[model samples]
Structure formats: C-alpha cells, structure tokens
Target: MSLREAVAALVSDGDLVAIEGFGHLVPVAAAHEIIRQGRSDLTLARMSCDVTVDQLIAAGCVSTLISSFVGNSSAGSLHELRRRVEHDDPAPLRLEEYSHGGMVARYTAGASRLPFAAINSYRGSDLPTLNPEIRTVTDPYGSGDIYVVPALRPDVSIIHAQRADEHGNVQAWGILGIQTEAAFAADRVIVTVEEIVDDDVIRSDPNRTIIPAHAVTAVVECPWGAFPHAVQGYYDRDDAFARRWSELARNPHEMHVWLDANIRGTSDFDAHLELVGHPRDGRLNVTEAFPSPVNYGGRR
Candidate 1:
C-alpha cells in the first residue's frame, strides 16, 4: 500500500507512535506524510528525538514525546521542542523522560509481553523525580530496590529500512536501534523502504530479516524515504537540509513558513524532495562494498 494509505489505515489521532532508528534510517518521509495528513496530538517515541521529532513538534502534530534525548542529532538544539517546553508556543508538549537503557528495557518488556522492566539505570539519576512513572520496588529474591519503567507498546510503529520483499519481510543493517523490539511491541507496523525486492532476495539473506512479515501491517516502498538521514545502502545524510532547517526552526513563524512551503506545499515526498534539490546523482551514494556471502545449504 502507499504510505498515505498505510498511515490512514493504521495510524489514528492521539496514537502513541514510535518511529525508531538510531542515528540513521529515521522515517522522516512517513513523518512528513503524517504531518501532511494533519495528524495531531500524537505521543511520539524514539530513542533519540532528533530532526524527525523536532519537525513533528514544529508542525504542532505532536502533543507529547517519549524518549531519552531531545535535540538535533548532528548539531544545535531542537528549538521547536524547546519552544513548546519552555513557552508552550504552539502547544503543550508533555514528556516521558527516561535513560536510553530505561527506554530499551521498556520496549523489550513490551515486546516480550511483560508488565514492566527493572533496571539499575536510574539508581543515581534525577529523571525519576521529574517523571514519576519511573518507580522502584524491592527485589523479591535479592538485596535492594531497582528502578522500573513501564512497558512501551506503541499504537503503531514506523521504520525505514534498506529494503523489504513484497511480503513485507524487512531486512536492515547498520545501527539498528531497537527497531525489531519497537515493531514487535507495536500493535501495527508500517515500513517505508528504499526499494522492494523479490522474496528470493530476502530469502537469500535470512540473517538480515530483522522484522519478519508476520509482524508487519503495511509496506510502503519509498525511495529516498529516509532522506536527510543516511539509508544504509542508498544515500548519505543531507546535512545541508538539516542545517538550514535548524536555522529556520529557531523562529516559529519561519519554521512554519518553511514547513508550509517545503512540506505542506508539496503533494508528496517526491515533490518535496524535488523542491529541496534532491535527486542528487552519484553524490550521496556510498562507495560500493560487499561482504562474503554465506551459503544456506538446501536439498538435504
């Protein structure tokens, strides 16, 4: 299905949406589509709330954020996030703050269908004070208390990958940040990929199939979808756009003007890319490299 259809069918207003990828492969295109569709009051989640989340907040689509860090990944602050937090400029943004470890444990617990996860991460931290959800209990069999974060089961989780087969079997590599856990924990999953390959291609590299088709609810083939964030084999991060966005995001009106002109002004991501000077031939491509192929013997 198209990204439009997927988001429309799977995502709803006020949904707890998780768009996961560490430093790269963030589903910024899907984010744009959600914004284009005018989704609001979302509780957005990611380990690092970077440009993607910043844009959502800037557009007044997000009402809350769940993550450890909130800043631009490459440089500078997420002024929009700061604006909402400090002044409530566009909207009141609630936050569920946790350490990176705490968030992973929460997602892992949710994926495993557990109630909560206990960890030693918040032992000496002050995050628990600000966010009261981080609680503690005495270990039944052991000595002392431990901090626990509740499970984070997102209503829908979106991820961008290098490729997936028509069956929605997703395969990704390099800096996969809890994407598997996030997808498993989600009630529905939407994957936007750079390309869609044959099942034979996905079967050729079974180890790379991090999220199987059974867990996926929608598959969207969107080349350059993870643009501005490096997709493993397709393109490099668009630092130029990020820098410009950061500067514009400093002023709320300018930020919305930019968003209106660049994102809302276009029909789809491709048009937005064209408007932003994308389709840079050969410039963003990575130098070709391949690893040794391992054989999965058949016909025993």
Candidate 2:
C-alpha cells in the first residue's frame, strides 16, 4: 500500500501518534495527510524540534500534545498551545511537557519494549511540575538518581527521509536520531521520501541504511517533501512563514485567520507554493511585513 494509505489506516480517533524530524527536516507528509483527513481526538508526541506541530495545532487535529518545546524555530514559544491548555473553559486542552533528553529516553524505552527506562536527568528538578506522573525512586543498586520513565509506544510513527526503495528500505542523509526508536516502538510505521531509488542504491551503501524495509509499512515519493522547511541540499528553511507563525501565535484569533488562509484553505503543497513564492536562488527574501528576530536563522 502507499505511504499515505498506511498513515491514514493507522490513524483513529484518540490515537497517540509520534512524528520524527527536527526543526524542518524529515517530517512525515503522509501522516500530515492523515491528519488533514480530520481524525478527531488525536494526541501527538514529539521529541525536541519540529514546525509541523504548529501546522497540526492550526488544523485543530491535535487534542493533546507531548513535547519538549513548541516554537517557530526550535519550540518557537508555544503561545497558542499554552493558551488552549491554561484556559479555564468548559474543556481545556491537555499538555504534557518534557525535557528534550527525557522525550528521547521515553521513546528509547518504548522501542526496547522495556518496562521503564532509568535516567538521572530530571533528578532534583521541577520536571514533576509539568508531569506529575514522573516519580523519583531510590535505586537499591545505587545507580545514582534514577528516575523511572514510562514507555512511550505510539499508535503510529510517521517519518520522512531523503530516499527509499520500493520495498521500504530508507536512507537518511544525515542526523539519525530517535527515528529508528520511534519506528520500532510504534504499532505502525509510515515513511515519506524525496525519491524512490533503486534497491541497488541502498544495497551499495548498506551501512548508510537506517530503516530497513521490513520495519516500514508504506513509502511515498514526495519531492521537495520538506517544503518551507529545510531539506538538506534541496532547500533552506522557510523563515518568512516561520516569522509570521511566531507573530500570529501571539494572538489566537490572528493565528486562526492565518491558518484559515495559508494552511487549511489550501488543498495541497502547490496551493501553499502559490501563496508563498519559490525561493530566489537559494535564499528567501524576508519582507518587512513579516518581521522576524534579527538572529532568526530561518530562510534568510
């Protein structure tokens, strides 16, 4: 089956989904399509950095979110998310925050199918303030400040890569992280790729292969897969939109309007492309209308 179909199949109401990517690379397009289909009561778990989270929130597809941070660049200040969670309304959103390392560790534990993972990172810290479930326990073996991290297996894991074969062998260009762990831990795995290369390409560089075919349930070819975001040699980050999102996030109503115009209103990537012109040469020109921090290292 196609990656899109696989992703769509795995998604059900109230399923916890995990996505792999950092900032603007290796996001699962197929999974986003599934989200676009409007499955209700979905929870998303993310490790550290991703722009897609904002897209999901803007879509109103996410009911609960567990992540280390949420912002334009790197956890770009989750202003809107905070508002939804903190609001004293009929139903407030649920949010669970974790440290970057803590998220990694949880996924790692889940992937390993272990009862729990031990870590000293949160010792003597207020991490429990964000998540009361985390408990500190004394280790009989004297392992030094071991905290039990519950396993985090998700209903599905969606990941993106530079290349993949028909059989689902994936080749990531750089920066392999908890992706493999998440894939292993999830009940289903869906992958999106820039190209469907021949098996020989993967066979030639066996060592470079990160996700083998058997672990992948679906693969789709999505060129410029990480549009408006970084895609290694193909393109840089989408600074203009990132800045606009950061600003809009500050205002809930403004964010809704922006989402309605640029994201939800659009059907496909082409529509998004029409709204935001292609990058000139290798860079995107930032206009005064979308003001960004001077140090913002987005598209530039």
Q: What TM-score goes with each of the models?
A: 0.97, 0.84
Model 1: per-residue Cα lDDT over 268-289, one tens digit each: 9998888888756666888776
RMSD of 2: 8.3
RMSD of each: 1.1, 8.3
Predicted structure 2, TM vs. truth: 0.84
Instruction: After the best TM-score superposition of candidate 1, give how far the Cα of residue 79 lies from its true spot, in angstroms.
Output: 0.7
Model 1 pairs whose backbones collide: none
Model 2 Cα lDDT, one tens digit per residue, 263-296:
5576754465566675544474333232232432
Scored by lDDT, the top model is 1
Counted clashes in each candidate structure: 0, 5
Q: Which stretches of candidate 2 lie over 4 Å from their true place?
A: 1-4, 74-76, 88-91, 138-145, 279-300
lDDT per prediction?
0.89, 0.71
Worst 10 residues of 2 by lDDT: 287-296
